[model samples]
Target: FMNYVPDMQKNHFAKEPIMTPPSEVFVTQTIYADANGTFHFSLLKAGQWGFAALGIGEQKTYKGKALSQDAVIWVQATKLP
Candidate 1:
């Protein structure tokens, strides 16, 4: 187990206790997409869950290549089937 060390920067910006960072902040599993660029995940026992995705890519144009960052998306979990 890792202990949380207080930080002035975070505490000042957040204006909250420089406390527990996050317990469930990391991914427990990774599901890779298939050749169809499609993938999925199972929630096991239905309950509220949260998910976030980040993607980056580069494209070539007539001039040069362009780099970009995809919009961050967060999906709140609901009852699952």
Candidate 2:
């Protein structure tokens, strides 16, 4: 089973992109970077998963920008390991 949150809102304008859980579990992480310089990270477990997107705009303007536009996300699962 999988739970997804589409069209999420941006919280703090300057927060690093990271995902945590209520408890630790085995997971596989995959990262994708587009030609536009945007990055997407996904975490997959046994039956649960989550994702984070980052837009490191311009590749030159790096001053006070949010590492992540959305709020920190957390996923929990028992079958992770």
Candidate 3:
């Protein structure tokens, strides 16, 4: 559990205002994708869910160092009435 940490100068889109960072963050779990590049998680609660795909892109290096083309997608779920 910690406050949101902004990306460093190494980020490719450090200047873009795509979205605002959360005030606080918590990592509930970390799961890796399978050989087929897929993962699954059971939504046990009804709220916003964030799926972060880290280092899953073809571009893997920058300035002779490793880089990550990370992505995030949020989903909202509702229980059946």
What would the per-residue lDDT of candidate 2 be over residues 1-81, giving only the tens digit for each residue?
143334346543334324455444433344665776466544344444555544433353447653434423445556643
In model 1, what lDDT does residue 33 have?
65
Model 3 C-alpha lDDT per residue in residues 1-81, reported as the tens digit of each score = 112334766654345433444432334568688988688887655556778887788988999999989888778777767
lDDT of each: 0.44, 0.45, 0.65
Candidate 2 local distance difference test against the native: 0.45
The model with the greatest lDDT is 3
Give me the runs in candidate 1 sitting further than 4 Å from their true place.
Answer: 1-28, 44-66, 71-73, 79-81
- Taking all chains together, each candidate's TM-score versus the true structure is 0.33, 0.24, 0.52
Model 1, 1-81: lDDT tens digits are: 112334676673333433443555533445566666566866543333444333533443335655454443334455645
| Per-residue error (Å), model 2, residue 11 | 19
RMSD of each: 8.0, 10.4, 9.1
The TM-score measured for candidate 2 stands at: 0.24
TM-score of 1: 0.33
